[model samples]
Target: MSEEKGLLHGVWETVKTVVYALLIAGAFRTFLFQPFWIPSGSMKDTLLIGDFLFVNKMAYGYSYASCPSIRIPAVGIDISAEDFCGVFKGSDSRLFGSEPERGDVVVFRHPTRGDDFIKRMIGLPGDRIQMIDGVLQINGEAVIIEEDGFFIETYEQQGPLGNTPMCMNGSVGIGGDCMKERMYETLPNGVRHAILNARDDNPRPFTDNSGVYVVPEGEYFLMGDNRDNSGDSRVPATQRGVGFVPLEDIVGRADRIMFSSAGRSMFAFWTWRSDRFFKAIE
Candidate 1:
């Protein structure tokens, strides 16, 4: 009988410890930094697929989107940020709000899908933005773009999604060289970063050239570093693209990459990109 009581007490103590640990972890994730894994090649070269980073949630203050979304398909758990902090939503303001500077890489919630997205902040509220002949134009002036050679990779399956990269050097068989025209683009604020163009010769009419977008107040314009391949503010939200994202949707700034893997799974230890560990984002 004494043994049974001892076993029950030990189980209860273990359960309490697990509960306490989960609560502490939840608070840390909610109020401080949140771990984010790059899942797409949109920010390539700058932020490659499988790159993992911790977003600084305190950078822009707390918003409803700051709450982490928990999604585990295998266990059938799918909770959105709205589910956790829906009451704090429905407004364009954030608690302890701070404006984000141009060229800062940010992770935010998708306006339509509520999924997380990371991109470089290109236009602030009330900024006139456009794309002319594959060049970024802000406030009636074109940003400077200096040619920076090429970004080359193997024309094969990449990351867990098994997506092939779009290449500037036309069609290539699997395992062949895939390349993109890389350039350093200087924003109006003097912040410069590398941008990739997959189709330099045949620029897309919609992406390379677009009508002027006067970003409304409390909204921001963001774009991927891989310019031609990104479906960003240039495209409308109705067309499955990230249009003008509200200020409240801004989650946090991605300051640095914690880890990176070139293979399909990060668990494949041999595929780790050791050089990219703790790499700073420009």
Candidate 2:
């Protein structure tokens, strides 16, 4: 049975190779970078629903929760990590890397929720933020806003037919366009970005005017590019909106779009967003 012994040895070697490769890949994803997918329109006009990007984990230093050094079982071989670490502080600060700057797009763990979220950093520690009649004011000064045109997108099969947020002004995208209000907002830090005004000047009391919030140290205030539709710092996390984000929760900054596909599966080549691929997230 010498021939049978040889075949078994060859198979064992192949399995070992695959396991080693996966271990290396897992370490890279946990320590250096991680792929992230945009699943909602919260950061619309900048980050689309089908957009894929990389979150630079190294930019914010290592945190237990950011990328827990864990293992994945491969081919019956338990590549178990002996040590796993993360932070679960009621409030905490960064461990090593630089702090998140204003206007930077960020990904973080939801303070009181189960999933991770991506949003724009609008207010830092000790900054006063408010929205008055659809205008954003920071530290008692109104941020600049310039009206642009409209942001239109085709409704996917999952989108509702009418009387919904996506189907704004029913038959808008199909007949003509899903006319969403567009504006270029300039942050206090001189960072300018596009924001969507889906509500068409209709101000919701809860979000449109949030009666001045003075951001506390070790926390941040975030918002979405889709101003009217996003559930951001303006709404409490208890209500499914991201509340004051603790600094320790931030995972990384999203710098560019890796690739995107309109189809439900990543393998759908026909639905690729070629134009947005490799595009820098501004």
Candidate 3:
């Protein structure tokens, strides 16, 4: 009888320890940082599919959309929220940081939908943006782009499995030679990062150029590194691309890649991208 009680007590203790650890981790992820995964090629070359990184939650001031899934255990503070402007126009805003700057790879909730989107911050408040024939123009001046040679990698697509006989997410390097025009683009704020130009493809008419768009106050213009492929601020929010993202919707900045896998699926453990582990994102 005593042995039975001891065994039961031991099991209960183990459970309590795991629960406590989970609570601590939940609080940390909620308030400080959280891990994120890249699932699309939009940020390709910079952040590849299967790249897992930790977003600095405090990089920008904590918006109501900051911790959208974490509920602080025991303290009763629910950081998990999509929008905190409850029953008002703008009620709960600002937690830390001042304003987002150009060149920062940011993660934020979709302005219209709650789905998360990550893109590079291109135009800040009051900045005029235009894209002329695949070239980015800001404030009436073109963003300087210097060719950095060429980049050839396999295109492991992200979609439903078993479709076109192409390599899936976990198997990135299995496809054919996918070549792209690579360059270093300097933003107005002097933030320089790599952007891709698919020479084989033409910029889509809708996203390539239309008219000058002046970013309204408290809003920003974002785009993906894969210039010709990304669906960004150039597209309407209702259509799935991120329109002008509000400052209040930004969640965090992607600083570094924790790890990367080449698998088409998250479960493809065999395709882990060991070379990309702990790589810093410029």
How far is 276's C-alpha from truth in model 3 (Å)? 0.9
TM-score of each: 0.96, 0.86, 0.84
Q: What's model 2's lDDT at 193?
A: 97
Off by over 4 Å in 1: 201-203
Clashing residue pairs in candidate 2, if any?
64-86, 172-177
Please give, for residues 1-282, the per-residue lDDT of candidate 2 as tens digits. 599999999999999999999999878887878777887788988997778999998787756546533333454543211134432344354567578899999988777653578999999999999988789999999999999988876654521112223544555544355668789999988999999877744556755676999899888999999987888998889987888988777878899998987666778788788999899998
State residue 260's C-alpha deviation in candidate 1, in Å: 0.6
Q: What is the C-alpha RMSD of each candidate to the true structure, in Å?
A: 1.5, 4.5, 5.5
How well is each residue in 155-228 modelled by candidate 3, as lDDT tens digits? 64542232221221223454666677788999878898998876433436755566888899889999999877
* Descending-lDDT candidate ranking: 1, 2, 3
Q: Which candidate gets the maximum TM-score versus the true structure? A: 1
TM-score of 2: 0.86
* Residue 62 lDDT, candidate 1, scale 0-100: 93
Whole-model lDDT, model 3: 0.77
lDDT of 1 by residue, 142-255 (tens): 999999999999998889888888998999989899999999999999999999989866556767888999999999999999987887887877786899999999999999
Alpha carbon deviation, residue 33, candidate 2 (Å):
0.9
Q: Which stretch of 10 consecutive residues in model 2 shows the poorest summed lDDT?
A: 78-87
Better of 1 and 3 by TM-score: 1
